[model samples]
Target: MIDFSANMASLMLPDGRSVRGPICCEDDIRRVIGQVADAYGFRGFLVLAVPDTGCNSLEANAIMTTYPVEFLKGYDSAGLINGSPVIQRLRRSTIPFTYDAHQLARRRADGKGDAAICVFEQAGMPRGIYLPVHDAGGHRAAIAFGGDRPVVSNDEMQELNLWAGILFSKLVEVRERDRRGSGSLSRREVECLRWAAAGKTTSEMARILALSEYTVNHYLNRATRKLDSVNRVQTVAKAMRAGLIN
Candidate 1:
């Protein structure tokens, strides 16, 4: 079995910006998250945007959702469960929560549960728990410990959120950096280019990054203009030459 506890310290992205260490591609993203899930013995994971995230562009660094590659590929793209109360609570609240699944079950008895969403997806179902980290701005993401038992309890929730908060806050800073020198690329744009250099297609990138294909392409195009490159491949090469994608 792979040991993830040791690997946790090395989960940052390549720029040394916020991700614990150098992770350059989707494989790296998947590998690290997969490790976290395995270490916690959770069923799956996801990294995405909270609803209050103020998006300036359709291709902004609004979110980066990750799950088992297969599941990500096959999940109902229609956002089948976006309106469930559990997810709504996940979004609006930054204080960690320990959902009383029994409470929810009782609510269900009174015809209150979202039947299509299932107990597995709900944190208060008495079986799974969602370990969420919500930034002060309400941009949040979560890791679900949905299996035979709960991996995240209320106490553990505080610790995990504290750790994740530090990492994500740094990421948001880099991704949304201000314009300068008449040619500034935000950190998110730089990251997208770096991944592209490593051969990640837009759709593949969208999966690792909680974004739509159009959004991924938007970051690429913006970065390309900033670097004055004529095309995607050229953009990648130029980014390398300028120390943007090393």
Candidate 2:
């Protein structure tokens, strides 16, 4: 578990009325969500992520929060609750997409396979607002709320998107800079690093990437040396912290 003592709640308030937020850290992600949930007396908050590649064997390092463990568990196991239409668009596009009664009402009466509509229709979700967030690499991630159903008017949505883009974009930019900063590792080296972070062995990585074990080892070794890691696991951890891996 991460430490939350640093008072880590420093998220840019998606709340329009007030501009106040506490300091945040990795651990505070949950605490902050709890605070938000209490503010509106909502059911829960869900955080989902899209990986750089592949659909299976993913790391659901995401957090899905809702009242009652049963509800959260059901929603989580159902899979793709995180990848609704609203979220898919948010990741690919440079805008924050909103899902609520107003937006959903505009869709065809037949529902025609709109992702957000489908997700909202799911059994466990609380009927409310959903926001899809994008990171610096253009990968999509999202947060869904189950509660009072906050509405984002056109003007509010525009304003939120503008600052959200800036806030998240900068966070991603810093992470990417850290990723690319390994004194400038080659793309191939970075790829190796990413696979390693996912707990792939060197031999496995070589087989997956179609590269020789020697080349793969060389890349990892060099990267390790560049990163000044004491060992392979340490190297991987450093790479992840530096955003060299997902």
Candidate 3:
């Protein structure tokens, strides 16, 4: 687990960097989310807006996520957002909750839940905690932490719930700022991000683009900075969200 201390005002990253309050950008929020997940024994976390009655796509509501890209694809493809028992619980409950794949599967009578559970289990995250939250505009959203460990205690839930609120609130702030002051990516940067989103390695991208690996990395790095992202993953996520790349 990651060793760190955090408060409403500041967070100490595992690498000893101090992000003192007010997460200013996507990169800062990503670091905060990663540190919080590690400190809580989770493999990764996802923050997304809860779809209302008219919303049909998970990708449309996703805020930011550290979950594997493939896992998300499978989850959306399986229609788990609407069919999964955990989501059912999320819709009705205001309190934080913990669930495992089998627990949810067993609750369904038609046995279709088993298929959904399989998709979740394949992500290597069999259990997780979910915290319900609201945006500044009062729209519902949730934060989830998933891993292989047993369910967390109520005390742990309380702590995580507090962290979730702070994180989500800061997320709203950062996203608003990002949208208001978004930067444009160059054509080469957009191409690099598109390939990176496709799971291409730097070397593979270089070969495909007929550029040196160093040149590919340079473009990616520059794109990352332009997007105020910490790494390639965040860069791709941000670029995709901004409609700069598919």
Candidate 4:
């Protein structure tokens, strides 16, 4: 869990609105949605993390407004994500869109819509806007704000898009940091990899560190195993990508 209370204590919007909160833990994601919903005058919202490759499988990480647990379970069990019209439209477009629940239900009535539409309808989310987010790494995600009445304005939708993108990116960063810490790479192994990344050979690293060549090789091999890399080049690449080594 991350304590983002301090950072979110005073968030000022360009439209002269202020939002303060103590957003902490995975559960706090719902809090964020609620806050945004209140600010935008919406009844509910959902933040979904969909991988660029497979939109059908949503990441374990997500935030949603109040909905029955069984509703979500049934949707997932039915694999409704694969047939979601919103996701299908998002895949084809680069801009945000608005969708009406009643329209979706009518379209799906003929068996042309996804089963997920029923889940949303049951939850009382009949109207909403979809914001597509693209990160620097090319990962795609989306945020949806749902309400019985249309409360989100064009400007509010733009702001919500920015806020959701930042929040999702921060979540990814926190997860990555946790993963690296759990890897438990040793100080010596990281040090050796750092030097190796700096173009230092095993012999050169050994001399510079006042260690035997065999010891340096041992550290390199250990790091390689820890990173699950088949060779030194791959080890260096993996370590660098993980920010374990420069």
What is the C-alpha local distance difference test score of each model? 0.52, 0.52, 0.75, 0.65
Off by over 4 Å in 4: 1-17, 21-30, 51-67, 77-79, 106-117, 183-246
* Best model number under TM-score: 3
Model 3: how far residue 171 lies from native, Å: 0.9
Worst 10 residues of 4 by lDDT: 1-10
Clash number by candidate, in order? 7, 6, 0, 0
Candidate 2 TM-score versus the reference:
0.41
Give the per-residue lDDT digits (tens) of candidate 4, residues 37-100. 6677666666665544464444242433343344556566667666566666777775777888
lDDT of 1 by residue, 1-246 (tens): 222233335443323423344554333454555455455555544555544433222113224433333333322332323434445676666555545444554544325344423433432223455556655565566544444445465545554454445434544444444323426666668878877977899888887877657557767886777778899999888778877679
Candidate 2 residue lDDT tens string, 52-139: 3334312232433434433434434545434434434544664445555336435534343344344444533435444556654556
Give the CA lDDT, 0 to 100, for residue 7 in model 2: 24
Off by over 4 Å in 3: 1-22, 54-56, 182-246
Q: Give the clash total for candidate 4.
A: 0
Of the two candidates 1 and 4, the one with more favorable TM-score, higher being better, is 4
Question: Model 2, stretches more than 4 Å misplaced?
Answer: 1-24, 29-42, 51-72, 79-84, 87-92, 100-124, 155-246
- Residue-level lDDT of model 3, residues 114-173, one tens digit each, is 776787788879899989988767788889999897799877887678778877877777
Task: Report clash pairs, candidate 4.
Answer: none
